[model samples]
Target: MLFFILTTIGKFLTKDEERDRELMARIKARDSSALSELYDNYNRLLFGLILSVLKKREEAEDILQEVFTKIWENAEKFDLEKGTVYTWIVTLARNKSIDRLRSKVYKEQKKQSTSLNDDDVFHPLYSNESDPLENTILSERAERVHKALNEISEKQRKVL
Candidate 1:
């Protein structure tokens, strides 16, 4: 009797294909409950994959949150026809981790200004100007990028 009951409970927990499908359907329909279920089911896996690539627990956790946020927002775009939900979540996690890695590297490099010369191309053409023409061009480019970036939704920009 004990064995039978235990086996029955185990099967109930793991063998419900309809339940999985239903949760996915709900997710596609923008159900918060479905997002909860997806997070409960896949967060660890995704986080583990991210930590593997990033080698930092806190960074991985942060990236995991961002990835799931995107997953929740973009659930409607998910297509089981293309691949399993596991694959999709893992891919999102991986991509976001790489993006974070690159961002961190960029920030570190930005903080360390090297090779500044009096005749640097970026030195301003005007005496009052802080930077040159090359610098002016780069600054303008940076400004345009900032403006373009401001046009994107905050949620979308978090990972970017």
Candidate 2:
């Protein structure tokens, strides 16, 4: 009994890569201190990886938190045979940063693909008009729409 207790206690007190894997196993058992320890150990390296990929301090900071949260959530799925804890964490940070970068790029591409006249969609149709003239033009446009709607068949109206 004494030897078994000593071995059990010794397993919980370790350092380096072996310690990290043990922490992950403890985290999978919902031990908060192990999660905190893992974060304390790897946060800097992961943050640097994220920053290099994103090239923005704020975005990198956010991604680092996201990566850790992902690790915490997925702790139960961690496989020691696959890789070291650092490799798993680094991969998470890199993948998340790359995903965020891709999203920002996609949004920028969408903006670029938009027509240059896109602003006109929201600009006053009669920016130069007096109040009365603007109202009149709006009324005319509304009337035209009403007329066009009336001219359409019920099926066409429903489709529109």
Candidate 3:
């Protein structure tokens, strides 16, 4: 009984690549701390990889946030037997960033407003008489989300 207890405690205390694998398993099982460790381990490298392609800081930052959001939301879909955690995350970041890049360009083109003298004209979404309360509510919501974001750990905050 004594030997069994000691071995159990010893195994619990050990930290290695296998521990990382276990953490990933926990993350797959819906543990949030494992998601934090996953972010701390790969955020910078993945961000740099995205920044290389996106070139714009804000766009890259948005892509980084989106990549990790998808990772945490989809952690259960990962299979350690198929690839290393690093490879899996990096691949996810790369794919998401590329998709963002493509869609961003499409959105920009769609939103372009031409001068009145030209064939196109800008038609605003809201008229000059639009309610100010709507704008105030949107601004307040943005501030609340920003404050809530600050409450999270730096590891999780980096991607955001």
Candidate 4:
């Protein structure tokens, strides 16, 4: 009886993994409906996890959206040998939230630095005023950088 119950549970888990794999395959094909289905299946659980990490509903919501956007973008990179779909997504949410927290701390430190003595302040060569010509050049440079990054393999990009 114990062997039969354990085998049945294993089969159920395998079926669940197979379903998640199929959803990921469809997402990689640019199927919006498949993404929607994935969101429907995982959003509540992911949201709870994000909310637990951030403790702010608004920021948690934003992170949840970012997590799904990442899922959509990186669907092709999923590997069964690495882990299940659930594990991958939960890791993404946790990492994103931690990043957001770190960014908030960095921004706070920057704000504090602005209050330092004039002699301690580090001045930049450039002004903050917007210039159309400079803006265009910066935009083009950003696009080039983005394209260059996309040309590299995901593993290499992650290492960078």
Candidate 5:
């Protein structure tokens, strides 16, 4: 009974994957309706992911729109061998959200630095104060590097 249930679940998942592939093929052919259908299927989930990253409804909405726009423009680049359609779209949404977030942080930093006068430079070239955004970015980069290092052989990882 357990084997039967697992097999049935697998069949349903395969059908969903086939449907996603069909939609992607239509999108690659420049079928706007297919794009709309894809958006309808994924928008809520993607929007929730974007909003979680951005923590702002308006910015999340903007990023979600951009994610779809990218999907529309780059449909031909999709490769099932690399990953499933769901993974591709989710990655696009997450990346767009992160890009927007990084830009916002950079803009805020630029604005703050520009507002400082010559007298502000006298404090020190470096300070004990930490910028939370900078720390977050550095930590993320470090985590990614650590993951990548772990993926390689020990010799290669040690050399890097």
Candidate 6:
């Protein structure tokens, strides 16, 4: 009886497809319960991933909260056809942590009047003002990118 019950519970918890769909629908409907369920299920995983990237508990916690807010606001963007909920959540947490890390690095660089390593592209102390020549070059590159994507096969495009 115990083994049977445990197996049943495991199967229920493992139905990620149904769970994600239900949770996403509820979140879209502004259901706090579903949001709480999502947070409870993935909070520790996201926190750990963020901590590994940010290397600070406080920052990780803050970014974890931000990630949850983002997920709540953007729950409709979750598409099973594209990826799993875990992948979406993990990517969200990872990106937020990396953004935080970059912000911190930029600030430190600004205070010390130094570049972030050999790449000074992120130096907040400097400004890249709008230039018509630069804008025209970027527009041409973007058009080329769109043309290249359209020319590629589905499999090749997916790999890209």
Q: Worst 10-residue stretch by lDDT in candidate 3? A: 117-126
> What tens-digit string does per-residue lDDT give for candidate 5 at 1-160?
3223323433344458878899999999999999998888878777876786688999999999999999999999998766567667876886787777766765765888765443343232224676343443355457777887889999997787
What lDDT tens digits, residue by residue, belong to model 1 across residues 34-130? 8898788767666766786678999999999999889878887877555445545656876787677666655655677654443432122224534
Candidate 1 residue pairs that clash: 122-132, 122-135, 123-131, 123-132, 124-131, 124-132
Error of 3 at 37 (Å): 1.3
- Predictions: Cα RMSD each: 19.6, 24.8, 19.4, 16.5, 11.4, 13.3
Model 4 stretches astray by more than 4 angstroms: 1-15, 114-160
Model with the higher TM-score, candidate 1 or 4: 4
- Quantify all predictions' global Cα lDDT against the true fold: 0.65, 0.68, 0.63, 0.71, 0.73, 0.70
- Clashes (backbone N, CA, C under 3 Å), per candidate, total 6, 0, 0, 0, 0, 0
Q: Return the number of clashes found in candidate 4.
A: 0
lDDT of 3 by residue, 24-89 (tens): 788878898888887776677677767865788898888888888888788888876554455466
Q: Over 4 Å off in model 2, which ranges?
A: 1-15, 114-160
In model 3, where do residues sit more than 4 Å from their true spots?
A: 1-17, 111-160
Which scores greater on TM-score, model 1 or model 5? 5
lDDT of 4 by residue, 71-151 (tens): 999998988755567657766886887678766655766888754433232222124665332343355457777888999
Of 3 and 5, the candidate ahead on lDDT is: 5
Order of the predicted models by TM-score, top scorer first: 6, 5, 4, 2, 1, 3
Who wins the TM-score comparison?
A: 6
| lDDT for 89 (candidate 4) | 76
Cα-based TM-score, every candidate: 0.57, 0.61, 0.55, 0.61, 0.63, 0.64
- Please write out the lDDT profile of model 2 over residues 2-97, one tens digit for every residue: 223322332333236788888998999999899899888778767766776678999999999898889889998888755557556765776787
What's the lDDT of the predicted structure labeled candidate 1? 0.65
Candidate 6 per-residue lDDT, tens place, 30-101, comes to 998999998888787677667866788999999999998998899888876554465567668767877887
Give me the runs in candidate 1 sitting further than 4 Å from their true place.
1-20, 114-160
